[model samples]
Target chain A: MIEILKQGWHTTIQDLGRLGSQSFGVPISGAMDLNAFQWANKLLNNNSSAACLEMTSKGPELKFHEPSFIAFTGAIMQAFLNSKPVKMYKPIEVKKGDVLKFSSVTLGCRTYMAILGGFQSEKVLGCRSQYKGVTLEDRIVKENLLLFNRNAFTQKGARVKTKTTDYKDVNLKVYQGPEYHLLNSHSQNEFKTKQFTISPSNNRMGYRLNEKILQQLPEIWTAPTLPGTVQLTPDGTLIILMRDAQVTGGYSRILQLSDNALNLLAQKSTKDVIKFELITL
Target chain B: MNNKLPFTFFRMHPKVILLEWEQDPSTETLKELTHFKANILKYSMGVSQITLGYCSLLVQWKEDIINYSDAKKNLIALYSNLSINSTPAKTKHWTLPVCYEGEFALDLAHLSSELKLSKDTIIELHSKTIYTVYFIGFLPGFLYLDGLDSKLFFPRKKNPRLVIPKGAVAIGGKQTGIYPNESPGGWHIIGNTPISLFNTKNETPCFAKSGDTLSFYAVDEAEYQKIQCVNNPKAYLTKVK
Candidate 1:
């Protein structure tokens, strides 16, 4: 068992999200960044679907109750083990009594902390993901004992570099949705041409982009917005629905990002400029 | 563009066809569109899922089995056959139990004051009316029902609370919904339900599906416990029609 020594901002346990039900209004609450989560688990040689800790914007501090192997990926928060600085995106060894701490983050909004064996929680609806609203527990604070299988994975001990794919400069691919042509050709051209910055209010629910796509096309009706769905609000703002986003939205969906493009948005930090790319005809 | 006239569409997605009835759609139009989607799912193209909302039905399919061209042809054929008088083959009806008192309904008092009605009257008004499950979205098993009495309608909270417990029955604008699993929400919560809106262990996780009819029944604390604790499927005496 590993113990939480410090609780960071909005850290929670997440897996591939609760799927199998969308008609009932459940948003898939899984790892926001699939690539980062898979990579973190891969370092520990754990299953890709294993539940891991998700630290948002900032990270928390944990103390090992016993010897354990762990890895940190995604957001590059200055990490330290036992007061000595540790590298991001690589597995590190910690003995009993060693404390792991994270300072301010410089890039991205979320980080993944994966142990050799995934963390354990009381499963709800077959999912152990901590949806703060549903589970009633907000934060995993000090003295919280998180359990995992002791002998889950064989110790490789060899460190692997976290794959840092450059998506910041890449053009995000988008498919035309039902409301695509609702925006006249002028607005559609503007949407494809212009770059937009992620608004500061962005979180798991959705990312509100600071753009003027809405100024061109205004009329819309209530429609089901899927994950990766780009909704254009009346005020020219873009709300990109995330993992924990509402199952349905009322905004006109001008563009629906391909599943691949959604991976890029998960790593995007506030103020990072991103451009959209149309899928090849 | 004519304000009242519905815009026609030959195509929406690569395969999917758009059939619009009105800009601000009426319940009659939504029901008709849902029937059209249901008809398409029955014979040709096994559309994996069909999502019905206020004004549209999103039909998702397995692109591997059916290409865009075939899907477009089948969709237009189905749309032309649809008529305004068509009714769904089957409609699911549900009567959920609600404990609308004390901490269970934290926002009840505020809602009563805003709507200028007593808490009991609010409960009476809420339970007396039958609601249509217009759509299911926002969360799993979270049914968005229409037909709330206009007197009870209110705007969502400006600043949403961090957490609202599961089974919280809330109202926002003209729509009423029960939060299956708690997340940040701005709905006016007037009651609590003992029935689990979503249970992943079951074949169908969401208790109420689209095109289902929902009614609320008032209950006390003891009754709430009996219903909440009963995990056995057989113990749920309420028949889902």
Candidate 2:
């Protein structure tokens, strides 16, 4: 068991998310950064879809009850164990009662923490994701205890390094949506040329970017939308749907992030400047 | 004006295509499209998933069996010679029981004031109307229902509640819906339904599906408890066809 000593802004347990339930009004809730999540799991040699911890801006301080191997990925945050500096990307073995803490990050938005054996929790809709203040009633907080398999984690100590040398820039690839032609040429040019900042109004549902992409579109009927769909609401704001987005929407979709780009957007921090690259193929 | 509709196919990506629709997915058209998609799925083994919405069908494909050109040609042929004959369809109509008193309805008085209708009139009008399930979205088991009386059109709350209880019957803008689970919502709560709109344990999580007809019934507080307290609660009775 591991105990939460300090709760950060928001932290939740997430897996590969629920599938085949979109038509039934279910959002696929999984790790925001698939690369980091999978990498963390690979370090532990666990299943790809094993549940991991997802943390935002501020991260939690935890105390391990049993010695275990853990890996932290995504965001270049300052991490420590028992007041000593530790690595970020590689797996680390902690003795029982060792305290792990994370400070604010200088880059990226969200970070992921993975245990060797995965977290144990009641699976809802075949997933263990905790949607704060949304689906389930409780959220992980200070003094909370989490149970896991001890034997499974100790089989092989991880050889991953703490420093992640391969951090990719947030350059998203997008394709024209159904209403792309509705935008005027000048507005479309501006959308491709200008850089947009990640806004604070971001969650698992959608990320509202600080950009003027929506100002270009002519009036049209509401259309069906999906995750990764970049919608331009009437106010010229860009709202990119995330994991828990609605199955359909009313706003005009000016651009849609590709399957690979959606994973990158999940790790973006507030105020990070990003440019969109049009997908040619 | 001639009613003839031409089928157009647009490339969404290498894996998907958008089937343009001249008309919205109505009850009849939805059935036809559903059958058409089923037909394609049966004959074309390469299709991965087909997502049907109000106005379009996003057909995703597997690259192993069919290429993009061949799949598009097959779809065009299927649409051009679409059989217009009616086929046997499954229809379900349900009567859901609702409670309109006390904490069960947080925004009843506010909704009454905004629409200029008394609380009783609001409840009566809301419960009496027959609604159709358009598409389920937003949250698990959440229904985007159509057929709310236009006179009762009201905007969503300026600031949505962080947690709205499950089974809350609410309205927003021109649409009406039920919060199947505890979720944050901006809809104006008119009443509470004892019925479970969604249950993962149930064989079919969502009690209602696209093309299902629903009618709401007003029940007093005592009846609400009686309906809610029982194990395997029966809040809505359905007529299966």
Model 2 chain B scores worst on lDDT over the 10 consecutive residues at B80-89
| Residues A149-227 of candidate 1: C-alpha lDDT, one tens digit per residue | 7666656775566668565555788887767867777787887798888888788878888776645565456666667
lDDT (10s digit) by residue, model 2, range A130-163: 7542345335766568667788744465565434
Number of backbone collisions per candidate, in order?
12, 4
Which regions of candidate 1 deviate over 4 angstroms?
Answer: A136-139, A155-163, A167-170, A214-221, B1-52, B55-91, B97-125, B149-171, B179-205, B217-241
> Global lDDT of each model?
0.74, 0.75
DockQ for model 2 equals 0.49
The deviation in Å at residue B119 for candidate 1 is: 8.1
Candidate 1, lDDT over the whole model? 0.74
Every model's TM-score: 0.77, 0.87
